[model samples]
Target: MTEYILLAIIMVFIYFVLIRNKPAPKTDWEGLPTLPEYKEIEKTTTSEGELCCQYCGHTETIERSLNSEKENPNKNKFYHACTNCKVILWRSEQS
Candidate 1:
C-alpha cells in the first residue's frame, strides 16, 4: 500500500511538471476582419485636388481622411480614405 501511494505521488508530480508549464500555441492573424492588408487601392481620388471619391461619388474636401499601411505602419505608405464610404481613394508611397 505504501509503494502504491509513492507511485501515485510520482505520477502526479510528473504530470504537473510536464503539463503545467507548456508554452502556448502560436496564433496566425489571417482571418481577423479588423486586420488590414497591404494591397492596391482601387478607385482612387484625384491628384489635381478635386476632393472627390471615385467609388461612392462623395465630394467634400473636409471629409477626406488619410491613413497609412497596416503592414508598414509608417508615413512612407500614405493613402487617402473617404469618410463617407470608408474607401481608400488614393495611395502614395515614398520610394
Candidate 2:
C-alpha cells in the first residue's frame, strides 16, 4: 500500500515538472543574418525641376541654383534665367 502511494506521488511530480511542456530554449543567433533596424526604402524620386524658358519658350536643363530659394531685402531675391537670352527674370516677394 505504501509502495503504491510513493509511486503515485513520484508519477504526479514527474507529470507536473519534467514531463510537462518544457519552455522553448533561447535562440542561438551565432551564425544567423542580422535584420535591419528600419524597413529600407526602395524607391527614389525628386520634386525639383527646371523652369520654362520665357525667351525661347523652351525648358532649360537642371542646375543647382534652379530649384533653390534665396532671401534678399534690397535687391532681387528670386532671379531666373531664360534659355540663351542671358536675361534675368527678377521676381519679387508675393504675400
lDDT of 2 by residue, 5-78 (tens): 99999999999898675976533221221112111212111234334444454444222132333223333333
Candidate 1 per-residue C-alpha lDDT over 1-95 given as tens digits, one digit per residue, 9 for 90 to 100: 99999999999999889998687653222222121232233433456644466677666523222342454455454455567787654444456
Pairs that collide in candidate 1 are: 44-89, 45-89
What's the lDDT of the predicted structure labeled candidate 2? Answer: 0.41
TM-score of every candidate: 0.32, 0.25
Point out where model 1 deviates above 4 Å.
1-49, 61-74
Error of 1 at 2 (Å): 68
RMSD list, candidates in order: 10.1, 23.0
